[model samples]
Target chain A: MFDTERVKLLAERVRPTAPSRTRLLPVLAPLASLLPDGGLRRGTSVRCGAGPHGGALSLALALAAGPSAAGSWCAVVGMDDVGPLAAAGFGLDLDRLAVVRSGPAHWALATGVLIDGVDLVVVAPPPHPRPAAVRTLAARARDRGAVLVVVGPWSADHELVVERSSWHGLAEGAGRLQARRVTVVARGRGAAVRPVRRELWLPTATGKVAAA
Target chain B: MTALPRLLLVECPALTVPAVEPGAGGDEGGRRLRLFARVVDALAEVCPWIDPVRPGVCTLPIKGPTRYFGSEGAVLARVAEVVTTVMAAGPALAGEGTAVGAGDGAPPVPPVPPVPPVRLGVADGLFAATLAARAGTVVAVGETERFLAPWPVDVLGDPDLADVLVRLGLTTLGRFAALPAPDVLARFGAAGARCHRVARGLDGELPGWRVPGTSRHLLAALGRDLALTEHQPGFWGGASAADERAAEVLTDLQRRLGPEAVVVPVLEGGRGPADRCRLVPWRPAGTSAEDDRGLHGRAQARGGRASEPPWPGRLPPPAPARVAAGGTGERAGAAEVADGDGAPVAVTARGLLTGRPARLSVGGGPWMPVTGWSAPWPVEERWWSRGRRRAARLQVLAGGSEGRAYLLVVERGRWRVEAAYD
Candidate 1:
């Protein structure tokens, strides 16, 4: 027996006061199940490590692909030889992507500057990095609300390790390489303490990420 | 907008000093400036208000000259005669190179240096007038837009803007002018908006078109100041807040690290992964005008159809995640490829492997069993020069099913690891 006009008016009035969307940068649909939050939480750090068979760089590039295509600026630091065409194939918008090459001495300084203005920063830590520098960078990233993706070892909120990888479309001197299949084991702290495993095509036939 | 001033421009193509050599106190640069000053002084006799646009170019208000000389054509002829005479007299003063004093005990006649071409034109504004001078045509007052229609957008002297415009299919001024003003402002920022106005003939000037401190250089060469006040153009204030913030941080980083340390990727047409993209130093707009002008032609060539052709024999996708830093083959790591019998493998003349690759060692590392590999793809480049390269590529999967993938190349009986799929 309620008046329909009154109900509609009341709904509109309450809608404006509803909580805003969570401050999470989106990841590709296929990668959603691998993370506890289903998206990258800003102001946190993620570590990507390689296993006996290396696929760490590919995984990092794929993770950056999502936010980059969504109009966020991404920078790659300390990886002097990172291939740009491959980054482009992984769905990153090259126009917004920058590459900063720094020697071991200035690696942290360069990465620190990028994290200030850039939305997402992917850095490869130098060998035997100073503990103080690592702590300072993590704290800065948190304060600036920027996501830091470390390619090498670092204690972070989440850790994604490439457990195993295999290539498809190649044989004994026959066909060419077309795609890569990998197993990523993701683990994190706090609410994301449970470990999760994902089987994915890091780069499928069209150079894009998809579930296997 | 108010009507732009109609002006006449004269250009000496050969007399202009290269912008790269600023404050060029060198002998050649000084000589050219002095010659140009002479040309300006000669033109002053015909029209009192002559403006030196650059080292070799000058302009004047054409209205008064036209009325005094009875027509625009008459004024152009007079200016042309005066400029030609001065340019022809320039080389005789340098007596060092051409036929030095004929040691014949007779009066020596210094050879005349070839006369540099002097072009004249008239248009409604300085931008159009400069282009008109280059074409050696006099554009009617109301026809500035029509005259600018067919010229390419690169003439705006902004390579980055021109590259984007060409990619968007607005190659000519008329097409660019057809776009609504507000949209250009929103998409391309203030610099683009200014160029858009110039394209539409709504504005008469563009930033960085005139050389700074030209009058000072003239005074130093002639020992007299023309009292020309330097015109300071307004700074661009149209960038978004995010852009400005990013630019500020990047500039700070550039100051800390060298300029070459920070780079951005530019895609180009080529067969190899390393060749397909190059990293150029990031430059914020409005800071380097001369460099931008120099890069204009290269940017256009890259963004045009010249780079659009599909390169045959290009490796199929899922390009390697890591490439050698240098495009040249020297930077690649030396690798050893052997057969099951431990004999070194080689590529034959027909682009075939002498034996099936079984074990591989990269950078003298431990050997790993090869799991899968592709057939050799022959690559022959620059055959006409001494740098001719005859090489073959093979995609090799090493270790095991859960292992690494690499792009291996062989040349002159030597193998190297050029890239990796990670």
Candidate 2:
């Protein structure tokens, strides 16, 4: 008969787990060395709500391409036609990539399913009218165990606000004319890690991330 | 004897009305949320030619239906009948105050009157339909081309295509479709090809029809229909009753799907690298069976982002309902939500559910790993817009077969679950 211990082991086998110790994956860093936790968590959601063309999506694409390059299936959900060009520019493998064109629910459903099958999944969280959906999606990720990346420009005028306790400007490259390096610092997640800063580069080929 | 095709673009902002209500409480509530859905069904009832529904995106693939109806006029008549029937049953079907009367004053309470009159505009092709809907002018067949000829090219929403059309000095769809296909493709790319299709009345020619509107996947109800209540705290305070109801719904799903069932959330925002997904073990409130034990091993699925809550440091307050239940209905039957209008109150949790977990294939062999590992992948794009480009990023994947499976990102190495492949 199946008991709690056996059932627990079976469940653990199906649901993927996070690496015990944080390790930086090898990759060219534009902000700094890779995060100490390896990368984004598998089935939760994280957002880069900067602005239009504010590097939110670019960040998401960068994050998704890393695992996808390693032969794991990766999916770009909800983004219509906008994905292929971006993926190609980064020199990430598209063969392992699938773009699903669907409405919000379909997008959510697809993202939820792909979370298990692919190495990474990214979704675009549209600004308001349905913030509840975003919350539900967050819980879904928790239950299903998929890395959920939610990025979009934040707008308070629309009644949607991210209540932050403090704000430290993320340092981007310091050059005579343009920014060459970028770093993001958090002031309040319990423990504080120094802001990471690194010069950014887009490699010309896949399986290669040498300093530019 | 070649003839130009009539095209129509219908823009019903009212179609977005359904989004106003949160979850499907009942079938009546669902109907109230999307009255057009009833009209679609009524059309099918009256004509039997209307296609089955696909959620999201409005344009119905009506070419077959139009052909089957014998002409565009016949199709229009059928649509009108559907509209009329829905309006006629508005008060009786959707409930009080939902149906508008001729003069207003809220249309006289319960047993409400029929639906109010509606305005329509028809023209040839997508643009024409859009224009007609905007103008409240419905065109008769054969006159579509003439009606559409004088409109501006900006209506299509593609400036590049518009500029090219202007350079070519081509103004009308009828004229544009007359041009060679190769030239259009060469000069304008995909947009040009699309324009040609619209001009030829072949725009919505794709054979299948997608149902328009969102459907909820999770539904919840307590034993013996307890009084459903809402506890809206002062601004982001304790979890609303809705949140509680939803949690129960999630627990039920996890139990049924096994601990391998992953919960992926859509996290809010961040600056430096943050976790987008994570996994929550399938340990519900009271039960942990050995069958559940075996299930927990499969937790290696995507979770959600690891970004600090936008609330920052201040944790989200507790929710009202502790757990919810999944209604014993299939996806199709579940599509009819009944919550607000005397129907059962149920919350729909929408996400992808899979019957089998992900298996990594190596050299024709399928392998399932019990270890969760993640690496960071960086992305930066759009240097041209706003003079700001994306900083590099790191993506992480996690989860182990013995307990959990997940994908996470470590931009600079801070981690969070991105999704659970349950």
Q: Which candidate gets the maximum DockQ versus the true structure? A: 1
Report the Cα lDDT for residue A40, model 2. 49
TM-score of chain A of each: 0.88, 0.59
For model 1, what is the C-alpha lDDT against the true structure? 0.78
Stretches off by above 4 angstroms in model 2 are A1-60, A66-191, A197-212, B1-31, B34-70, B77-121, B124-137, B140-422
- Report the lDDT tens digits of candidate 2 across residue range B262-328: 3322122332212211122333222324323313322321122232345322111111000101111
| DockQ of prediction 2 | 0.02
TM-score of 2: 0.29
Candidate 1 global TM-score? 0.59
Give the TM-score between model 2's chain B and the true chain B: 0.33
- How much is A125 displaced in model 2, in angstroms? 15
lDDT string, candidate 1, B1-422, tens digits: 44777889989766665542333454555677878878888898776556677888888778877887999999998998998888777664544564422343334433334534588889977799999988889999799999999999999999999999999999999999999999999999999999999999887678777664454465456644211111010122312333434554565455345557777777777778887777777755443354343235335534653546687777789888888776645888899999999999999989999999999999999999999999998888777999888888899999977769999889999998888888
Model 2, first chain, TM-score of 0.59
